[model samples]
Target: MSVDILIIEDEPGLSRMLATTLGAQGYAVSTAMRADEALARVAVDDPALILLDLGLPDGDGLQLLPLLKQRCQAQVLIVSARDQESDKIAALDAGAEDYLTKPFSVAELLARLRVAQRRRQEAAPVTQCYRAGELVVDLDQRQVSLAGEPVKLTPKEYQLLAILAQAGGRVVTHAQLLQAIWGRHHSDDTHYLRIYLRQLRQKLERDASEPRYLLTEPGVGYRLGDGTA
Candidate 1:
């Protein structure tokens, strides 16, 4: 299937330019001029990835990140005019997988989208059984066990755990996890990630406070003790 990309940019010219460029590159493109509109668009058309502009007329794109994650399965990459280092860090910290400042090249945008698409395709299927440390998740069988004893996971909780296990040891960004487990449109729902992570720890961690297997990268993402890059 042609990869679908959503462009949430306020600039009409930029949005049209990007849509034209990506559409010419054989991608299915969708554009939204405001954060609220973007959310509404995501609800209707499930895009594979999103190109987000930080400063929106209706609301800040950063604030909408967690909401997007909870509402739609979208992997968001910030494409905005904001140039401050703090802006970049804040966006990344807020769960954006990548950041691209204004005046970016169309070629570069295409390349980055290619990378994101490839990564998504290359990802191992989130499946029934996953093992990391003493925790094992049998998703298909609806089973979980820690150190050989049966454990329980809510549907969302199990999904969160499965994603971390699939990530191996490499950090799975909050956005990535949100997109994987929740949906691309809901990439902004960090609250869901946090809540589910806590639940997973309670069930799988020897000490939920000082977890070993489900390690958090502070503001970035999560990783399993197993080996994933």
Candidate 2:
């Protein structure tokens, strides 16, 4: 499949330039100047990845992260002028797969895209089961175990857990997980994800109040335990 890339930038020139550059690199490109329009495009035709700018006309890019992730199931790479350390962390915390400051080189953007795509492609389905300390996930049977005991989960909860585990270590956004597990129709149900994540933490965490494996991305999404490559 041709990898479709959505560029969410308000600057017309920049959007065109990015589209042209990325297209030349053999990617299908779509551009949006506003968050609402971007969200609409993503909903109708989910892209494989997104290049998002935080300084939008209608809303903050961070606020739209979940929507983009959930509604479109795209890997978000924040492309913004905001260069604060807090901003980068916030974007990452919000479930963005990566971040790029403005005035970025097209080469760098493409390189990051390659890295993200590689990580996703290399993800092997959990064969029969996976164990991380006390947490045990049986992919085939759709069952979980904690501290040598079985733990029951709702269908959504099980799917969420499975997504995180399969990620290996990389951050999986709210949008990606939502679309993958619940389908595009249920992508906007952020509350459902939060509730189910909480349930999963309660079961797998030694102290669900202070989770170790099911780590929250705050405004973004959740990830598996902190172990990342």
Candidate 3:
């Protein structure tokens, strides 16, 4: 499963920005504009981290903070325009993991997320070179090959293929692949997958029209096979 995140910001533009930014980093993101909606999402989605704004259309973020904390185990990171010291103290005391005033840098936001998620990832396995049939993925050296020859791939194409390679022949959902590539920006966009997969097969397969390795799982997702199945 992918890392899940919720952005509780009301601004459409900013919400989209955060969702897309986080989504591309391999997070499964959901958004809520109102306090009630936020609460419902918290109870359902159970996000790993919540990026909250102090001002909501239905209620003050501060007033809703305690309610959110009481219901879920997520780490709340307040992203607000309120920069007063007292405001910060109240939020921290109310159980926020961290706070960032408005107009924050994306770098800092990502850094804070890493810190919040560090503990959960303390035992994740290190990625090693992978091989299946004629395909070879040397993640450490950042290279891929088909059969005995090198195959050139665009950065996005490589990312798409690497994700499948890492799946170890198991099917990876379409949403997972899209989120990793463009975040939530390409939700329900099947054409993106078609284009990239076609490109990958053209380079990796002996005949793109009759793919032997990149197999589609009907309505489910895609899987990589060693062409022996």
Ranked by TM-score, the better of candidates 2 and 3 is 2
Name the better of 1 and 2 by TM-score: 2
Ranking by TM-score: 2, 1, 3
How many Å off is the CA of 217 in candidate 3? Answer: 53
Enumerate residue pairs that collide in model 3: 23-183, 24-183
Lowest lDDT 10-residue stretch of candidate 1: 162-171
The residue-by-residue lDDT of candidate 1 on 80-127, one tens digit each, is: 888886677677656676788888888888777876776566456566
Question: Candidate 1, after superposition: displacement of residue 41 in Å?
Answer: 0.3
Candidate 1 C-alpha error for residue 220, in Å? 8.5
lDDT by residue (tens digit), candidate 2, 16-133 = 9999998898889888999899888787667888999999999999999987777766778899999886787678767788888978887898899997776556555547566666
Model 3 weakest 10-residue run by lDDT: 116-125
Candidate 2: which pairs clash? 69-175, 70-175, 94-220
Over 4 Å off, model 2? 1-3, 123-229
Error of 1 at 209 (Å): 33
Candidate with more favorable, higher lDDT: 2 or 3? 3
Top TM-score prediction, candidate number: 2
